[model samples]
Target: MLTRTRMLAVLLSGLCWTQGAWAQGSPTGPAVVATIKPLQFIAQAILDGEGSVSALIEGSDSPHHFNLSPNDRLRIEQADVLLWIDPKFEVYLAALFADTAASESSLMVTASAISGLTLHRYPDGELDPHLWLSQGNALLIAQALTEQLACIYPDKAPHFRAGLDQFRSGIDKQAQALQRRFSNQHVADYLVYHDAYRYFEHDYGLTHSASLVADPDIQPGMREVLELRETISASSPACILLEPDASPALVNTMVQNDAVKRITIDLLGNSLESSANAYRQLIDHVATGFLSCLNI
Candidate 1:
């Protein structure tokens, strides 16, 4: 049986042939848009200098509450290729794609729909849309993007393939280094502000003792907070991983022990500039944040 990656490569090759030749090499190439920063980072790496890539949601904006303005809608409509995680992750874009002709476009690539992704689920069994947190998933996403871009710009196919090779090499090297670093240390108990890092934690052999809330958009109620406090008291977690914008006051209220370190991990890469290396940097930042709070 063919691997999913091999199957996807075959499908993409057929797409390139059926779509026919595209006019290549305009001033800036195609306008590629990603719904969020992390997706944008992957596209940036694959596009390299071959094209432009931008995110619809930037800075500290949470996709859960992001509102699409008229300008944002126009950008999506005008984009040659649009990449996003899933409809469930970016609920704002779900309706637009559902109602508009954009859904029919061959250029629209939803990462969730991509083959061979190791998707996770919440305890209640809802699809976990944070698939990009895994380096393996990121490589698969890059492969899909590279094939799609190559189809659009046959002239730039070599550059896009080269970009994909470079991205895979960088990610593999970084993952190996992280695995080595983590192998030497004993697993430390930790708590998370929310259950956003399941993919990351699973990838690096780390696990959180408890999560204050399942949804980042929802704050923990009194009952949930009390329970979390009890768990903290019982486990004495080495660290409590907080989101970049998470309130330290809440953690302070739950944790009175000074030895319990608080570390802010930005899964969205909000502070980093857009570059080919941005995805790798994001992974490194997350790993360093975890290592810092460890007892070692």
Candidate 2:
């Protein structure tokens, strides 16, 4: 038979022991998920050691054509923070965004949340969502992401800020170097398979005189193709730019003995492994592609 004081002491001892074990358990950072590779690269740079960063969409699949898998849905649902471009950029994510925006997990960050962005509008009044191509926009994105991450992990705010600063410094130098590289080349006429690089052209002061298709998912009409052919015949653009995985047959047919240069530029960074410098590598690759074609 235990005395009252003994029973109280035993209860207190067990409580303390349980708490000690609980405290011994390691703490984990949040699970962060970005919708695309570029976003993942930015997040990985900022989160580095704080938490793991992952992208839901990968490979050569354009974000415009990506169909979310069950695993992707699960990843989004489980994420402590979910980041993506505007719903207009990723139309497939519109429904999931609606649900999440309505629920408690409104952690989705968009370009609108970032400052100092130059938004592009089409003749039909649709906003271009490829703002990530601009290095300035990348800085704004890092700032917005760092702020959100700090809110989620207040204790780690300094860490996130430091990462962001490093990213800004690195990207700034890369952008400047790219500008210098392009500055020496005489402005040249170019053609593209899609209208996705307007932001890049705008940022770098280059011109894409013609585009075969307005949308990547939709096949260009014969009229549009013929118009592009005529434009190329008339202008004799220095280069025809295609996406990384674009069909060589179609590309060859478009240029068709015109003796024009053909180069592939990857907007999605699909060929490079995702890392802190992946964004820079993507920009560098684009610069190299442009220089190769334009110099010819």
TM-score winner among the candidates? 1
Over the stretch 1-296, how does candidate 1's per-residue lDDT look in tens digits?
Answer: 32334334544454652232233423568678898889999999988876678899888788888988899888777666778887788888876754432233325677887878899998799988888899999999999888877777787889999999999999999999988888767878988888888888888888888887677666778988888788789998888889987877787878878988889988899888999999999999888988887754
TM-score of each: 0.90, 0.86
Worst 10 residues of 2 by lDDT: 16-25
lDDT of 2 at 73: 84
Could you give candidate 2's per-residue lDDT for residues 1-296 as a string of tens digits? 32324323432332221222122222577567888887888788888677778887787677777888888888777665667887777888878865653353435566544546777876788887777788787777777777766666667879989999899999988888887877756778888877888788888888788777676667767777677777778887777888866767666656665677778888878778877788888788878888788882
The per-prediction CA RMSD against the true structure, in angstroms, equals 4.2, 11.4
The lDDT for every candidate, in the order shown, is 0.80, 0.72
Stretches > 4 Å off in candidate 2: 1-26
Number of clashes in model 2?
0
